[model samples]
Target: MKRIIVAITGASGAVYGIRALELLRKMDDVETHAIVTSSGQRTIAHETDYTPGEVRSLADHHHNPRDIGAAVSSGSFVTTGMLVAPCSVKTLSGIANSYNDELVVRAADVCLKERRRVVLMLRETPLHAGHIELMARATNNGAIIMPPVPAFYTLPRSLDDVVDQTVARALELLDVVMPGIQRWDGTSVVPDDG
Candidate 1:
């Protein structure tokens, strides 16, 4: 079984992480391990209808954010990769600086050191130089900083469609192919005549 770690931080878009877990659960060969930070739990409660426990149930295994000794905290855990859905700036700073104070950052650090894919769905806007610098540092350390930006080309009809598409793209970064995600085939663009 391929193991994948999914982390949800204090960022506003808790649904990105939740949706990732839900989609991964349908794949027969994938086993998902989840980490929901305390702030993440609060965010889920405030932004979505599902309780933290309900979100946890979507994954095959769930780890406490404070569990620094968990299996995923080591490079030897041999996960395919990790996805930090809606990664907050705090978590980004921790991972970028290699500060493994908690399970989420520790697991992400492990993945980076193991040369495994680590996709962070940063959920912030109005980027300042500091945010950009953090993203650069994490990128230098082999982390893919992916913000949850929706694509308009998909002609999404609902908020669910937008979230699913963004989550699907994040999963794709980890090489997890989500079926039926809309793709840009270039056929929709019209050539300029002017």
Candidate 2:
């Protein structure tokens, strides 16, 4: 079974993380391990319809955010990688600087040290120089800093369609192929005028 760790932070886009868990559940060969930060729990209550427990139940195994000795805390645990959906600026800073104070950051740091793929779906906007620098640092350390920007070409009619498109792209960064993802085929290319 392939182990994939999904971490949720306090970022505004809690739905992205929830959608990721829902999609991962459909796969029989993948095992999902989840860690929800305290801030993430609060955001789930405030932003989404589902309770924190309901969200955690989607994963095959759940670990408390404070549990530093959990199975995924070390590189030896052997995971495909870790994905931080809706990664907050604070969490991004921690990962970029190699701060392992929390399980989420620690697990991400372990993945980086082990040369494993770490995809961070940063949900912040109005980027400043500091945010850009941190993003650069994280990228320098082998983290794919993916912002959940909606693709309009997909012709998404509803909010759920937009969320699914973003979540599907995040899974692709982890090299996990999900069925039914709407991708751009580039078949209808438009000519650009100089």
Candidate 3:
């Protein structure tokens, strides 16, 4: 089974993290290992109906963010990749600086050093130069800084569709196959001849 690490930081958009895990859990080929940060727990309560424990149930394995002894903390620990759903600005800064004080950042570092995909779903809005710089740094370090931006082209009917579209796109960055939201091509359904 392919082990995929999913980290949930204290980002405001808790639904993103929950939806990502819920979707991943349904996939038979992927084994999800979740690490929920302290902040993430608070966000779960404040933003979503599910509690931290409920969310953890979606994963095949769960690790505390503070657990440095976790198998995923080391680069030698093989994993398909790691994803930080709704990654907070604080976590993003820590990751950009390579400050491995916890599992979230540490696992990300491990993924980067091991040349594995690390998808960061950064959730801050109104980003200034500093936020932009951190994103740039993360990108330069082989981590994908994917902000949770919506796609209007999909014409989503509900909030779930919107989040799913972004989640699918983020999964695409991890090379995971998902039925992403259908996008409209500029041209017509059939080829046009002048």
Best by TM-score: 1
The TM-score that candidate 3 achieves is: 0.93
Q: List the residue pairs that clash in candidate 2.
A: none
Selected candidate, larger lDDT, 2 vs 3? 2
Which lDDT values do the candidates have, in the order given?
0.93, 0.91, 0.87
Candidate 1 per-residue lDDT over residues 1-194, each given as its tens digit: 88999999999999999999999999999999999999999999999999999999999999999999999999888999999998999999999999999999999999999999999999899999999999999999999988888898888889998998899889988888888877766777232221
Q: Which ten residues in a row have the lowest lDDT in candidate 3?
A: 185-194
Q: In model 1, where do residues sit more than 4 Å from their true spots? A: 189-194
Clashing pairs in 1: none
Task: Estimate the TM-score for candidate 2.
Answer: 0.95
Ranking by lDDT: 1, 2, 3
Clashing pairs in 3: none
| Tens-digit lDDT track of model 2 for 1-194 | 88999999999999999999999999888999999999999999999999999999999999999999999999889999989988999999999999999999999999999999999999888999999999999999999999999978878899998998788889888878877776556874232221
User: What are the C-alpha RMSDs, in order, of all predicted structures?
Assistant: 4.4, 4.5, 4.0
Q: Provide the clash count, candidate 3.
A: 0
Tell how far residue 144 is off in model 2, in angstroms: 0.2
Q: How many backbone clashes does candidate 2 have?
A: 0
Q: How does each model score on TM-score? A: 0.96, 0.95, 0.93
